[model samples]
Target: MNSKDFTAGLAELRGLRDEIKTLRKQLAKLETARDKQITALAAYEKAKAERIAPAAGVSVADVVALAPTLAPPAPPQPQEEPAPTPQAATNAAGRPEPTGVPAPDLRRAPGKPAATGTAPDTTITGGSDAPPAVGTPSSHPGPGRQPTTTPAADGEQPEQVRELPSIPPGQDGDTWFTATPNLTSTRPNFTQQPRQMAFLDATTGVLVHRDTTTRLNLGTGSVADILIAVYATVPATVERIYITAGDPWHRDAERYPFLRDAVAAWLNGPLPDGWKIESTRGRDRLAGHLVHPRNPVGRWQRGDQHTEIRSVGEWFDPDGATPATVRDAFVLLWRALHRHWPDVTLMGSPSQTGRDLWSRTIPTKAGAKWADGYPVMSEEIRGLLHATAGQGRTELITPPKVPDRLPQLIELDRTFAYAKHTWASGVGIPRRITAAAFAALSEKDQINALFAPSHWHIRVTIPHDWNHVGLLPAPAAGDRTWHYPAEPGRTFTTWAGGAEVNLALRNPHTPWKVEILDGLLWEAGSPLREWSTRLKDAWASLRAIAATHGDPKQRTAAHLASRAVRAILLYGIGAFAQRPRITTGTVPTGAEHDIPTGAQIIGTDGHTITWQRDTGFARDPYAHPEWAAGVWSAARAALLSTKMREDNLFVGALHLPPGSVVAFRTDAIYTTTDPAWPYHGHPGDYLKKGHLPGPVTGPRTEDELLSLQTLGRAHLAEEQEHHR
Candidate 1:
């Protein structure tokens, strides 16, 4: 071989080796891209199967059918133009610029088919109108079109979805907003209650508006607001969201009504234009949140100090509370429980504790609890109930009973030190029997006879022209939440929108010249009378449970029983018994107040009433609702109304000195020092039940006593500062 040929061949061989090395480098880059595509695909599949696809399901029962193919429309044909460069696809921050929901990535890998769910390829691809490989980006339409992976169901139109634009500078809320990890990246799904959060979707950096027939109004606020608190902004894309997160803040419902109410409000998504928003109630905005999302469940410190849940090892540490205790609590709040806004599953349900205890129905006395024999309403009257709704138009809530100054309460620094003395357990249940107990019995004999069911019950009315002038002194003008006025026989809060009538307030010595406007009797007239049998049955069940169970279990049973009692008393019976009035006929004693019932009693109240002259099924007020069965349901007319009676009559009677009560809970009083309370809470002091004693109970240990005192002191100081 010639020397020149050898030199040339050697040079060519070296060049070929370099080329081989370069090819290896290219191969490494392609492999890396393939791995990324695989990861992204897995993540997307996980999100879809668990979050997106299931979310797209029509009902909780259809989670499996929604995989791979779902409600979104088929992918549009790929754009003919060359793919955009990396710089063109993203903004200054390097995050992809928004185009449309799940836009296609047109940049393709040189050899491999584009994997499902890979991030958009940013390299340029030559202009090609033809479809790319079956799984590649060239097959999908331009970025402006909606998702293309799934086609819409037959005859169904895929609704266009849009994100909430960032609040404009003019409407921008608190820029310094903070978020707690309550609900993270979750929203409700179809067929599941947005409120129950049963079925959920990821909180798209914005919520997607589904073009579905179901008209659900997702109220204002998003679970992503938690991100705003964490990152000061939502993640740039849905891929960053994970809906399976458990509650980062384990606060329960009743203790955290703000969160509970907020969850309820936010489930409907943002409020539409003209939704009635009481700006003061809580509408003041903080970024995307309506109010300060404070945590209600505080962390327990080294000891038992309750404070914010920021303590170390708080959520992970096992709470020492027994499972039975937790179960009981769950039963009580089963109505408000939620770990799902997206991360979803069934958590709990009511057990047999209640059903078994109250299994036996207590038969009503007098042969017929009401001699009227539970008359059924006609279809016409029932239609009126369906149209007008068996509900009242009036409702009001009692204001806080606290005094502006808590100087005395703060000074005492006693935590539940004073025993709370309420009326006898039977006070709300007690009443003298009537001749209706047995129609054949004489009225005089009925009043003195043993307690029994009755067809006739007293209904008192207050005239339109009445005020607390000479007799009962009303609470301060500014305070409308309270209206007990220390009058006996007034077991419930007086009507906030009308003249209060306590027939017991009538001067027995100077009785009014009453008129029997309706000589006719009402069926089981008084709610108190109507509910007596049910109420007694519940109490009996509670007693039976206590007798059956041992400690802790017995205690929990009693508590559950008490909850039922409260539910019946405040909600069930309270609804039906509202607004019973009697004509405040001429008071010969010349007393200046005429407490009456009906339309006249509501004259010149704070609210303005518009009288509707319409008639027939749509306008009738006397209609009975279908839900109102014998003793199973309360009248719908009263269901929507919420009236807060002072659980302690002492509040209205002015028993405690001004500013002496720190906090008033269910049946306990928190004060800095004792206020000469009726029950000194000595050992063995038990609950007061008139002459008979109740279960002996109080702070079990000195530590408990001290803890209460400390909590009361801190709360008093905090409340005082807030008031200031």
Candidate 2:
């Protein structure tokens, strides 16, 4: 308890204090180490979850193939087997590199583990056998190996050699490409990852392909050349290319023949070796020629304004300079004919229009009759003929006695100016024709109308100003589309193709339906040439009738009546009556030779035609209810052929041999429980039979329409189901 004890105790207290200080220091160091471990664990978990999982999913094959191109890690050779210092390493390209091992500062340690698993692999280093360090290229190749190539030091690709992702056939998706902005990143000196873009291909979906510099360059020249080059370069295994048909430059099917031809040639002929080509046309390219003509000529007016009209034989004669030589001459003559003598009769078959007479000296009937010599008519005669033969002339001209038979000399005058505006007159033969008639014809009688030529060109718009007048063989009871052979002592039945009639019906307010019917009838004959003479006579007679009944309402009624008369005519032409008498032997002079029993002709005025019939004759065999059922059955069969889609009757015509006529025979009054049925009775029935069913005569309630409603719903549901 003395000084010695005190000193010893003080020394013990000092030693205890030193020991406490040392213990505190050790505890602090341990806590720092624990915090670092926690951080490193957190970072490892994040890297595993986000980056590693996604990259791993890329097929091992794809990853390995791309491996050699990846950046290599810095050297980590051990110094005397010293512990590995986990410092952030730099890639060979001097960019900040991934550490492979999660750093203590970045990751937090977990409190506990559900279970301990295998330790992580950390064998990565600069040596060739090391595991691929983060950002470093793998030493060993993986599956689906791609050719290895060195990347540019600047991280910028040469624009051409950069391998783009292979676009999988039939599959559309975003594509990645090296972008310019990332090419030269100075701070990180890192290559920009591929930029995502929508690549467009005709074969591709709505997603578009990015336009790379190479693609742009390929498109720089003539479209045809570019297409050809592209086709040559592409592997032949590719069946077709994805292009833009809607591209503004190549939209018109008519104008870009070269481009289209190039595409076809590429598909069929110019493909690369080790590959075969197929076009979008699929397997039947030849059958598609009709749909896509190689070099389609446009409407008549589209060609040289004046085509040197020359005979097919004369233009091609060995000694002849030919049509091409006389192109300008023919052009001048055409301008002369079209501008000055627009009404001069045209020559050649129907469909050629006026092209046949371009360079030829065609003699008008009057000109030929009045010719002084073999030249037909001289320039002096032409002068005397007046400067413009097409316009109205009131000089005294004798009307030739109503011809016993019409001569086939013809000319078509096109002056249809009133085809658009509403008409002032109530006369409704289609408002446009009414307007044209009023404007072209004088109050007294003369009216301007279409004249048929022996030959003429058919064009999209040419039909607008012309009428086709040629003989078609009359149709028989069984024959609906084609004209039948005329035979004596047999009754004829007339029918029309549903398509033609429907086409005529396109105009909502057309009034010339009846007239069209009549015209159709007069032309019915075997071999177009057979009906030419008779057709002329009929046309002249009709014209006379039209002039006679010029009153609008009367004309309208006459037009309707005329349709029936034409139908009867068609029947006669199809039967053994008038058609046989004219076509079989010689053309008939008048009605006396081959009179029809069912109907009697009363008048021949163009505006109104009269016919007398018993009105109670039994229905034609083709018009019987059984016939209707057969037609419906046929339609159903055809629907089956189209996979249940209702197709046009013309499409079915392929089943028929060439020259076989086709028609869709259906009741004009197509009323049924189904509301979709257009009419309640036949169009011809009311006129011919004088009555119709009464269900259509009365007002009906909405609830009473259950039958039609159910049918329509069923039909629609079927359609939807089929689509699905």
Candidate 3:
């Protein structure tokens, strides 16, 4: 609109046009420099590829071929020479051309038959017949490529073929291409070989090689032979081969000297690639280590059935072989192995050997001789001997000499008899006496003397029925019909109201009664004779004391004297009778009708008496001389004999006819009268009998008799009152 605005606008447009012209020239220069840089980069890459390809064991063409961009495109041929079949593309050799790159074939599944004689198609994006890569994202199907609908064959399981990524040339200053040949076609073919086998002899600990044609006994073969034989025999396909060493292999080392070395060599030597060799000792070896082998490769069948081989060694015969033998064999094997290869891996535990193999392998040093002898005498024997002798060590033992004197002989005989009896009875005899006996008698004498009887027998009479006898004397004429004959030679019989009475006799007469006559004769020569004389003197003394006291009743004096006599006799006879005696001996008839040398006269007081030719008695009559004298003195003062006679006379008087004289004798009197005869007619008759003088109590034991005597002397008045 204005002249000045139009002129300014035109000046600005002219300046702008000049600036645009200069920018166009600059852009053209930049484009020309960019082109030059691209052309120079291509030429530099080609020169680098050529320089390094030789060192990489590859040609420059190969390097260029690896990179598609750098490779020259092939010129199109007249669609005439139809695309070469995989078979037709072979080089001068019959083998097909190697595919420089691995390519997936989608038309045929993996692991399937590659159309007979045709190589696997590896052209991924080249010819019209090339199939599309699997899993490649695409919308339209290419020409001549129909969608595959038929399911793959049963054996046509496909495997994904991964193509290794291409490396750029000069990367890491190296250009290398790894050719992945199809393993299915390139793997070397192998024909299977027959299995070569060998067995270990269980009995001999030797290896026996076997084949279809012949069997060879390789007893104690060299280590090398064993290794080669085993290695060559087993199949190449076998990853692990096991050799079993039997028990004998471990046990008899002398027989199997090379077994250990052989096994070691076999294990340590080189094997085929991907191959291994393993071995087993035997069941014993496994059991010792507590290892159980699984999937045994070798086994014998019962008939024709396939069975696993559990053990390679001997067939174990439990009945014929000992476990100890087998175990010993294992120990030997272990020791051998441990000595050679200390770190060898064993199948079974070595702990079962129960010994430190390594420690045992060390040689032992020689030591001083400790002992050498058959039936060697040990410290225990010495100690035992020392213990036996009370003081000194016993260097030697000898049998004691037989006793000579009659007294000594009798004592030895008695002691031996007592020991034997005690042993037989299982009752413990005083050790002091037994030891003395053993010391006195020789071993032979001891054995012979044991058969002799040493027990005592005392004939004692008590009321047949205990209830009939009370603390009182029976009436003289209460019932005459109850009376029975009591003569020594007569057999007592009785009747009640014309019915024969079956009276129970406490002391039945036997043929042994005749022995009493012999006892009486023996008593004359024994200390009992002296005891009887002393008793009579004590009685006389009691009587004299009673007379001086002005006791008119001679019965009381006689009773007291009789009591003293009885007391003396009881105590002395008891002491005499308790002596050990030999009861077994021949009873000489005529000239030697006297008591047998060691025959015993057993008393009723549980004592025994044996005649000693020298001493009159086996044991001393007065073992307690002072006590005997005191007893005599006390009897004299108390008039014990008189009291005893008086009580006896009183009892006799009560039993005899009313005016008849009843004598009290100091001599021992054997009676056959039954004290229970009168009371037996009626059960309650004993209770009706009134209290009588002197309690009618019978001592059941020797101790009871002593107690009664003591009580009678101490409390005569109380006893008398109770009796009354």
Candidate 4:
């Protein structure tokens, strides 16, 4: 067999082995859980019975009837593994307690006052005939038991009952369980962290730290304790130490004495052969021996398994990211990172969304306070390190379960990734942008474009002259400046035709202008034409997926995200067409702009066009218009307004009063005689207020126009200001 086949077979075998191990452990957990339930229920039956020990002839129906009283409402849990709740857990007396964990419960974290609850349960054994003696310990201690320090049960498999610290109750019993964010993570298994996590792998003894916010490896050890743990053993994978910046030896030395000392030792210690992280001048500082950006200094090496220390902090700038955006951005980034690196460790954070969403409720008795739940790393996370911990499994990964209520956002992320991959370079991750994703791409692109200029940054003018029309429903008087409404006989993009097929909305005072020069830029095979079609197709697929199973809210988010695509495809190219390839603005203030080809703009007077051609003759800059102002603007004008207005790209066309027009906004026509389209009642992108007008697709009399002239004049001023 070939080497490739052998490698593939070997990988499959190893994966199967891990899968078998995971399955066996999970089965063992199920058995333990089932045993705990059986134990609790049996004890409960005996306790509730007043007469002789009630274990005789108890049927299944009676036990089933009692379950609903303590069981938490089951929602659509992703993994189908229902998490054990306090009500379902086997307490010290080994019975399910409704109030909370008892004082003797060992699981409560140190210093936390044990909750006041019912007496510890007695273990029921020998066919539930009688309870165990008072001091006897139950087989299963349930959820709140002191966390087992042993990594695996009997040292055979990983821990089954992971330490998932639940909400510490208030005087009112922590009534805020529903307020939990129900967050989605980029990590598979939908793992979420209640707080940032750091760990020393149970088996490997290798210390690891991960930043959940961005899913990147934060520096392993900066805290003195963490440093001691990292070097406690010269780990197989440890080669270089990466610091956030040069010489962490200044103020940091005092803050992290242990780390500083380690650095000093490594510096003064004899260097290993093939050691790296060189420096000449700053030997006094680790910066001289070590780093910048991510200072990587070799700790040790075993051919091919180089152990290096990585300082991974400076990259995550949380300045602009807020709690809200960070949450949304997490959903977006997680999807991208997960598909790229599935099977990576999942992290958890105490949910921030709960307190914020229910913040105003705090003043009332039922309010949620800011106390975070005790967070424990998810089993998915623990499993990650367990499988490869001491084996130096430092690479990242994620699992496949999606968060509840976040399917739509996840889909948007998937679509965005597909779109990003369309760029010349396939890497679509935004390394620079942080702190939460904005609902609008315009905001994100504007903020993150600093990494490099994108097509979104290009700007050019689309010149045009004002053209008049003969009023509503009547075709404009100029050279085809406006398109009359047509049939909704549109396909793919043109839904219900007419204004719906293109950009033209039924605005009362919105006049149609005709292009004076150049061919249609959005005609078949052209960039704009291809782009709009592609966007329409992409959006159509997304819309179908959303409508079939998604809710209105998802559809709304999908539409908002689509604007970024439109900006890239439609507007991005529009910016390109404004200037031909060879374009030069006037070097001097008064000089004219110059274009080498395609619809060149030429004018002698400075005031009329303000730019002129400076080719050959060294004319005064102030005396000439830009030398290359040519046909590009005219083409741009055609694409931007003239042809585009008639292109039929409406977002749910409104029914306008055919004969007598009123006013209009992007989609809604305002004819109520009070505030019109330009006058907004709210400060958002979309707002609708008008009732449907009569189905009249003809012209009104000049007398009707006369009465509306004043309103028209007022609207015209607002429209200009709004656009400006």
Name the best candidate (by TM-score).
1
Q: Rank the candidates by lDDT, best first.
A: 1, 4, 3, 2
**TM-score of each model, in listed order:** 0.26, 0.15, 0.14, 0.19
On a 0 to 1 TM-score scale, where does candidate 2 land against the true structure?
0.15
True-structure RMSD, every candidate: 36.6, 43.5, 63.1, 35.0
Overall local distance difference test of candidate 3: 0.24
lDDT of each: 0.25, 0.22, 0.24, 0.25
Summarize candidate 1's per-residue lDDT along 690-710 as a digit string, tens digits.
110112122334454445455
Candidate 2, residues 1-724, lDDT tens digits: the string is 9999999999999899778767866876885665454334335422322232243443221221222112123223345543322211222233322211110110111121100010111110111211111221113211111112223222333232211111111112011111112111011112212212111121111222222212323432233433444444443232222232112122332433355433222222222233321212211111111111222111111111110111222111212222122222223222333443343332221122212121122222232221211111112212211111111101110112112222211111111101100011110011111111212222221101121000010001111211211011221122122322211111111122211222211211111111120110011111111122232233234334445865644433333223322322222222211011110011123544444455554323232222334333221211111111112222222211111012111112112222221111121111211112122221111111111222221213334223333443455556557999
lDDT of 3 by residue, 1-724 (tens): 7999999999999898778767866875885665454435446644453443454454444334333234432223335444544432332233332211101122222222111111122111112222222232223212211112111122221121111111222322121212112111011122222223334333433333332122224334432333344445443232222234433213323432344422222222333343332333332222101111221232221222211222322222222222233333333333334334343222222221111121122222222111110011122211221211111011110111111111100000010001000111101111111111222333333222221111111111112222121111101122211122121221111111000000111011111110000000000001122223333344444445444655344434343333333332333322312222222211222324465554442211112121222223222211222112222211211110111121222111123222111111111111112232222211011111111224224333446434544453445456457889
Stretches of candidate 2 off by over 4 Å are: 1-295, 298-323, 338-472, 476-481, 495-724
Once model 1 is optimally superposed onto the true structure by TM-score, how far is the C-alpha of residue 204 displaced, in angstroms?
A: 26
lDDT of 1: 0.25
What's model 2's lDDT at 84?
24
